[model samples]
Target chain A: MTEAHSQRPGVEIEFRSVTKTYPGQDTPAIDNLSLTVPAGDICCLVGPSGGGKTTAMKLVNRLIDFNEGEILIGGSGVRDVDITALRRDIGYVIQQVGLFPHMTIEANIGVVPRLLGWSADRIKARAVELLDLVRLDQNFAKRYPSQLSGGQQQRVGLARALAVDPPVMLMDEPFGALDPITRNEIQDEFLKLQNEIAKTVIFVTHDIDEAIKMGDRIAVLRQGGVLAQYGTADELLGSPADEYVADFVGADRGLKRLSLRLMRDLVKVSGENHAAPADAPTVKGSATLRTGLSVLFASGSRVLKVTHDDDSATVIGTVTLDQLQDAVYETAPKAPTDVVVAGEA
Target chain B: MSFPTQVIPNFSGPNCAGQFFCWDWVGANWFSVLQPALIQHIWISALAVLFGLVISIAAALYAVRNSWFEKGFSALATFLYTVPALAFFLLMVPITGLNVGTVLIGLTGYTLLLLFANTVTGLRAAPPETIAAADGMGLTRNQVLFKVQLPLALPSIMAGIRIAVVTVISLETVAAQVVQAGLGTPLFNAQRNVFTTGLITTGLLAIALALVADALVVQLQKLVTPWVQARR
Candidate 1:
């Protein structure tokens, strides 16, 4: 059974003209949606409540079935696969974390594996490996979910989803219930974790900033479940499809775009004449341009030294506000009239 | 009064008789009749509750899947509960005869309302998010019912069972009228013969039995649901 779904690099998810309408509702919840999440990419579906963002995600796992059209996982129609087997192969994490209260962390994480009838020793080994993957202490495996903090519970939720090492994962506002500080902290850790695993992920959220921060590609849905735009984060922010997309992305589109670029990407090679000033604030090369900009403002300095730590902290270059601004514009050129025409048409 | 030697009917020291209290009568009859009655009472009540739980859980699982069934079954259970216990036993006697069967049928009917209603309520009370999570993770309908929903509903279900057990214990005493067993037999016999000692002792024992059953069920609930204790 395990060999049947032996880990592929990542599976692509395709939604072809799919629609969902709840009983007795005149309008469909998901209206003729067509989108694709490429292999090994995180595609975020974001919109206001009642926009069918969640409905679209549920259709992937068939938690709820679609009314029309096909939802394909790796080119095979979802209807063709045994649903339980399909679900076991696709990881799912939710905002509430739904860790079984009666079960210990180890048992909760090993649910899918146990359901697949893996050996006891194999399940225990998998649980230990997952706890470490989620950056949790191994001792946590023996504790119940009630003993953990909210953020910790969410990590356990992720570990449980990843138990079978499924090539695809569906996350519905996974960090939506946490405090802002914890949410930010988890988001950073989550991005770092994603880099190592690289599962094909379909992330659903109402928060656009979170989408911008996490999505490799984004599908913006409107209230009637219509797809407003499907593009890269920079494309959506650089040139929104229409007024709704523009307003939805918010007024600070430029600053949001700055978050997409790293400080290392913008750093200028320091000439011999330009030595780092003693008062200049130093930023790690891996920091975001947004962080670099914030540091520049707080320190009230036009220039800041950027460093990369190999064995020791070595100053690599200096970055200026003008340089940061140039980097943002360079990536997101002013939208041509033709670009808006292409979006609207 | 200057009465004959036998006139007072042995009203002397601890052997008092015909003195509205009779220790001598109680001592002689306690093991011979009352001990078996107590044991029969416990056995009948335990069986009734066990049967009621099995039937109720099955009905609750069915009811949860269909709203129409839930409404209809709840109405039927309420109707059964409203019938007087004596009337139900008498009604069952025509089909089941004046045996333990008649007594158990009546007692089990009384337990059904609490067990069925609470089982349904407990299952429906499971968090929607938890149910969705279970489904999304590939739990089949049956697996979800047994593994996820049932375990979470245990506390509410246990409370219902505790009430049902205690209620059945008391109701079983009344079964002695038709079945010829249980504590009610001694009380009924004492009433006919005007034996005050037998009546009070049997009544007190029944009450004590019910209290012990309720306490034991409470302990079982606490033991099974460690998570609820941790929350507090």
Candidate 2:
């Protein structure tokens, strides 16, 4: 492991005018894709199937090499570093949850560290710590991957990626293999985990909703490997760059943005009443503003009561449809957030 | 033809017990004749199989890398498998002379198909995703093959070895006609005089050797691949 890679903090990943054209094909797989994922931030890349979101993420680790321009991690070009060392330092997770079936969970998670030649005791300790971090039971360390469910396997895959405590993580639909219920549960758990670890991430997914949920910043790529817009979810929702982006974010962009903000935050921010009248329909404090609006409409009431996240008995506040609507309007794009780094013709 | 008729004793000759599988002759020849033939049978089979295994491993690895080579070697392995042991021995006589090497060559060639297929299939048995993940985690191509793919493939490869061993043991009897080695030599001698005792005893010994050899390889397979047993 290099000195630069051993540090705990996440490092910046920059893709500058990168283009990847496969042999025997005229059209490039990734056409001059450029995005800067800042340290300690999650930048999700979402688009249609052929938009090259995965190809873009793979380029950072040099899993897929680019023919034009350069990809730099924390200031040094990826080509300059040893390929094995570069990948070992960058966490990678895929939709398949590719845990070695032959290896026990502990060994699977300790793969990169073992590759780095860490002592046995250190690798074992790291496995324990990561299992706890990923919320797996301690006893699971001894079990093989075949014993685990899809969600559990994906968790192991994530733990394995984080084994080296890599600064940057490239995840391609990491939760896509799970059932919807498990996907939602793991997605919530992963978001919570991300808040604590805060590694710079380049997340690739075809689902726009997932991008909106997991990304601090979302890059919306269109067909033909072109970036339509790159900005915060609110920026994309509030002020889309073009008709293509506006359509890509969908007709329900307003509702999608509401899902990003919780009812508790709105209640805490708007200085709304706490513990409103019992007659109003009760909505959980943890419910997003979008759900609050749904409850308001479903109840046919003027306002809806929001209960505390932990103690449902304690009412947090009341929210009106008008208030939720006003919150949506307040997010209207003020200035251009599209920062495409494309330097190609 | 189904029954071995050569084991009948030459009752007309002196000390010939007029019965099938005469124990008296067996007791007298156990150390002097039968024992030597039995030991030589096992030795030839072991060396043949060992040579076959080494070649199969190298060929299988190469075959997996090139599709055209895989296709070509597959046809070659099939053709080698169909060459009857008697014909195989006959073909080797002109090139290898009446030496033990001729017998060894034929016996070893017979094992190549079984071992090669097993090794190649075993190596490819590793999940593609697992291999890709290993590469993503910084393992080189060789490391992935040796560490992940090879271990995952052990069960199939060992299974192939077990089958090849039993097969080579059976084929060594055919080698007796070529180089007068192994149990085949005594069986042929019994046939010349229609001695049921020698024929039955030698044939039974060859079968016993095959059974014991098969069991040994099975145990070895289980030892090397305890994970497969665990899975079951």
Clashing pairs in 1: none
| Interface Cα RMSD in Å, per prediction | 1.7, 2.0
Off by over 4 Å in 2: A1-7, A272-278, A307-317, A331-345, B1-16, B67-79, B91-97
Best by TM-score: 2
- Residue-wise lDDT of candidate 2 within A61-92, one digit each (tens)? 88888899998889999999899999999889
Q: What tens-digit string does per-residue lDDT give for candidate 1 at A80-162?
A: 99999999889999999988887788989988889999999999988888788788999998888889999999999999998
True contacts kept of each: 0.56, 0.49
Candidate 1 wrongly placed segments (more than 4 Å): A1-8, A21-28, A268-282, A309-314, A331-345, B1-14, B18-24
Interface RMSD, model 1, angstroms: 1.7
